[model samples]
Structure formats: C-alpha cells, structure tokens
Target: MASKLTGTVALVTGASSGIGVDAARQLAEQGAAVALVARRKERLETLAAEITEAGGTALAVEADITDRDQAEAAVRQTVERFGRLDILVNNAGLMLLGPVVGADPREWERMIAVNVQGLLHTTHAALPHLLKAAEEGPRQVADIVNISSIAGRQAWENYGVYNLTKFGVNGFTESLRQELAGRHVRVGVLEPGAVDTELGSHNNATIHAEMLDPFNAQHERLVPADIADGITYMVTRPRRTAIAELWVMPTDQA
Candidate 1:
C-alpha cells in the first residue's frame, strides 16, 4: 500500500493560512513530508502540530519569502531535513484593490513584493534541488506550482498593479515550463478566481469595501481546499503528464 507521494518532500510558501495551509496538509496526507514556510511562526507551528498529530511529517520554517537570504535559507532547511525537494507550491501573495489615481503606492509595492518578488526568490532558490530530484528520486519527476490569479489573464478597473504581478507569474511559469520540460521538472500555473480567503483584508477601508462589492460576493467562490485539491491533482500525476497551465476560475466567472 504505497502512497501517491511516498518519499517526496514538498515546500509550501505562505503556509500559515488559507490556500498554503490546505495545500500543505493535502500534500502531507498524500505522504509527502511538508515544509511550511511563512513569517507567522505561531500559525505555522499550529499547522505543523496538527499534521504531526495526524501522522504526517511537517516542519514549520519561519521566513519571509520577500527577502532573498531568508527564502534561500528556507529551501536549505527543507533539503537538510528531507534530503530532497520534489514539490514547491509557491502560494504566497497579497492583493490590494484601488484606483491607480487614488491608490497608495505602498499598497502596490507590497503586492509586487509578495506576489512577484517573493515568488521569484523562492523559485530561484529551489530550481537546482527540483532538477536534481527529477533526475534521481523515487518519483523521477518534480513539480513547481505557481499560484496565480484570474487577474493574470485579464485586467480589471482597480486592479491594475495586482494584474501586473499575476500576469508576471503567468509569463514566468510559461517560460520556466519550457526550460524545465526537458529536464522532467514540471512547471505550472494555477489561476484562481474569487477564492474564499482573507486575501483582501490588507486593503484600506474604502478599497476593502470596493473589493467586497455586492457583485463580487453574490456568487459561490472557490475555497482553499478547492485549490488544494487542484494542486494535489497536479503534483500526483505520473511522470508522463505535465499540467503546464490550469485555469481554476469559478463557474460563474466568464
């Protein structure tokens, strides 16, 4: 009775809550030892405890992915603990909604740092390990799942800069997918639309209100588990399969 991800090691960023937590849990359930990386030590510890209680191996690694040294260290710790890296779920991101004219530049900066820069830092640090795992591991394949948003596919009125960061994710994923496809390191992007999470809480009152407008909340949205299921599916596929791009928008979305 071998598990799907037996002997695999996965690192999930933004793992303190929301999609990252769920994805990490699911990966662990499938028998991959998980490294939970995030700035929130308390939350990561709680999550790691729960996974350990459930008989899954998990390590809480506190690091801010926005910092290059911290991001690299996080990767190093995972490899040091697990011996190899098989899956990387780059799920950390921030979203701030406001018109470009009246928006605070700081909000835009935060989104760019977490969504674009943080993702780049982690991916850059994990590439060599992932390639090695693909070359020589039980699975003989590796996965990098970049969590993008629907905004990456199209632009919205008040989401200009957020759009920029997510669109950059799409481009980076595509380019990396081509480069790594030859090495059996599968690179993919998961685009989620209107997921049920606290992704908008960081915005100011007005911007937050605008983000929660009636039209946006009227329909059922995806949950963290929903995206987690998708991530699990993407990573569990056999070496012959590579899910290069996945659009996981709600059915109500156009």
Candidate 2:
C-alpha cells in the first residue's frame, strides 16, 4: 500500500521532545519529509539522526519560535529543502500556572510570547506555503494543527494566564479555519489535558507543590504518545475530511 503521506513535507515546531517530537516521527513514518524545529540543537540533531537512520527524511532546525526571524527561517528552510509544505504543527508553547494575584508578571508575558505570539509567527510564515501546497500535492490538502490546552475551554483560579493564551489559540485556530476552508487548507486545534510532559516544569516551586495534590491523585496521567496519536489521526485523514477540533484527555480525567 502507498504511504499515506508520501511525497509530503511537514514542519513541526518544538520538536526536540514530548508531543512535538513524537508527532514528527509519526508523520515521517507515514512518509512525509519532516522538519524538526526547536531551540535545543543537540536534541533536534539526535532526533533527526534517528529518523533519517530509520529510512525517513528528516531535518533538524535549531530555532526559538518566539523569535520572528527564526520562526520564519525555519518555515522557509523547510520549503527550500523539501520543495513544499503540506503540514504545519504549531506545537511550541509555554505553560506557567499560578495565582493571578501574586503571579509574576514576567511569567504571564513569557506565556503570551511563546504560546500566542510564537504560534502567530510560525503560522504567518507557513500560511502561503501551506495554501500553495494544497493546490497540488500528494494529498491535494494541507493541514495546520495548533497545540492548545484543555484550560482553553475552562477557567480555573490559578491558571489565569495559561488559560488566556490557550483560549487565544483556540480562537485563532477557528478563525483561520474559516478563512482557509475554501482554499482547502485545513486548520485545527488539538487540546490535551494533564499530559505527562515538561509543561509543568516552568511553574514556581509553590505552585508546583500545590499542583502535586491533584496531579498525583489522578492515577492515569497521559503520555506524550497519546497526544501524538490524536495529531496523527488529524493529519492522516483523507483530503475530503477535516477534523477541526480534537480534545484528548485521559479517560480517568474528569
């Protein structure tokens, strides 16, 4: 059988580890030329080597998505190397949750920059290529998957800024989907809940300790591959199908 994504090109931001890394690998396994973008050169290089060694096309792009120039460069490099861009996964994000009243203002700014602005920068740069790729490509369709959080859908006391950024991502993804629907460019959002990743590492010690209570109580914490599975399903669909919004949470999660 022909590979689902044969002859396609995909760019995944924050692909050094976690969900982004897994998604890139899964896409490559389906036959897309994968560009892995992240700030950690060593990690990106290692992952790229693994993918290439496994008979998949892979490129390591060291970039900070928060930097507009770097973000744009990553997308340009993908097109320059692969000749077209079929998938853009805006997976780079920051989540630092704490009480709104005493939370460091800097943390809020950082979340906004990485979670919101970074997505905008990458999407803005990749839009033209994605639209063009949809015109004529292996699948005749292109996809942009923005990684959001369950917090985007609901508000909690201490997660004010993180929720704000994710909510912005949801709105942005929906608006872009509407704008690009006629063009055959599918835009979607993947919202995951309490995944076992480094997302919580940025939280302050106090907040971390506070989070441990509920986090530990939940026996079934989600793995990175769980989120990757949802993403893979989204992009691997036939050109005629579009999964606009996907919410994935551990079955035990409530």
Candidate 3:
C-alpha cells in the first residue's frame, strides 16, 4: 500500500511544487510524517495543509537549500519535528540551458548552486540523522533519493551546464551508495526524461522561446506525480531490498 507511513519521517527539498510537492504528498500518503522544504513558504504551507487534510502529518519548512545554513536548518527542523529522518529527497534543483559560447556565467553558477551544491548540503546535513534512523527506526532502513535527469546521461550543446550538474549528481549518489550500504542507508538517483514541470520556464527568455518551449510543445511530458511514484517505490522497499537507480522516460522521449 502507498498509504502506510505510520512511523517514518521524510524530508523533501524543493517541495513547493512539481516533483517535489508531489513526492512529498506520496510519502505522506504512505504514512510518513513529511517536512516540506523550499524557499517559498506560502506554497509549502498550502501543500502541508492539503497533506494534513488528507490525514497525514506534514511540516512546512521554508528554506533555500542552496544556502548551506538553510539546508542544515531544514534537516534540523525535520529532526526536531519528528525525531528522526528516514527519507531524504534531494529534489531541489533547476536547469538553465543555453549554448556555452554566449551563455551567461550567472546561469551556470545558479545551476551549480542549486543542482549540485543544494543537493550536497541537504544530503550532508541529513546523513547523520539518516544513519541513526537506520539503526533505530521501525523499518530498519533509510533512504536518500537524489533527483537527476536524462541530461545526466546524455550531453547536448545547450545543456552543457545542466548536464554537468546532473552528472555530478550521478557520481555522488553512486559513491554515497557504496559508502552507506553497510549501514543500511540506501542512496540512489532518479533520472526522469522530459517531465511536465515548470523546470524550463525559468530559463532566460531567448532560451525559453527558441529552445525549451518549442520542444515542450512538440512532445508529451511526464507529470510530477509520475516522478513522485518513482520516488515512493524507491524509498518504500523492505529493509532487505534496495533499488540502486531508476530511469523513467516519457513514451515519446527518445
């Protein structure tokens, strides 16, 4: 059952919208007390209310996880609210795409800050708690799920920076998985292709119009809940089972 998180607590970053919020809801539905982490407080609060109305426990934590202090605080708040964190979803990231030749360095920096640094900060802050949870939790297991993208696997001209960040995520998750396996803290990555999120809407106007929007209009996209479902499956396995990686693509996305 997806709605059975009776005693677990989960922290989902970027939980204001899209894959983040939906994944948080899925975890909450599955019986976990969820902590919603994102910079946007109002949205997080709204999502938290909806989860509560659905008879689930949730905490809305406003945090820009790109900032290390905020990331630490987010994890601390989760531990304070529910005593332990059994699941950590590092889903707080953005992509700003353009050709490397004339791209703004700021864009690259922003992608690195959130996609790479943000994930790192959250994972680092939550690791100790996750380790402890694995030792003293009802499920006898813990999970760290990093959200990546198809760009992580394939590089394209305009996707250089985004690709770099996701590849970093891939490498980091694998290394962490190996380090934490013996401790029962399962670490993994989810690579979803062309999800129907507002991920590209934030790109520079030129990139959005010429690069992102056209492609988005051409293809069917996976919804946020689709990725959320993947996350739920990864984190809910029995203590003896660990799903190392998952790559789900839209039927039309090659």
Model 3 lDDT tens row, 1-254: 45556799999999998999899989988999999999999999999999999999999999998899999999999999889899999998898888899788998999999999999999999999999999987888999999999988989988998999999999999999999999999999999999988798787788888888798899999999999999999998889999989999999886
Candidate 2, poorest ten consecutive residues by summed lDDT = 212-221
Score each candidate by Cα lDDT: 0.93, 0.91, 0.92
Over 119-194, each residue of candidate 1 has an lDDT whose tens digit, in order, gives: 9999999999999999998999999999999999999898899999999999999999999999999999999988
What residue pairs are clashing in model 1?
A: none
Given candidate 1, what's the lDDT at residue 201? 71
Residue pairs with backbone overlap in model 2:
none
Per-candidate clash tally: 0, 0, 3
- Find the 10 residues in a row with the least total lDDT in model 3: 1-10
Q: What is the C-alpha RMSD of each candidate to the true structure, in Å?
A: 1.0, 1.0, 1.3
| TM-score, candidate number 3 | 0.97
TM-score of each model, paired residue for residue = 0.98, 0.98, 0.97
- The parts of candidate 1 lying over 4 Å away from their true place are none
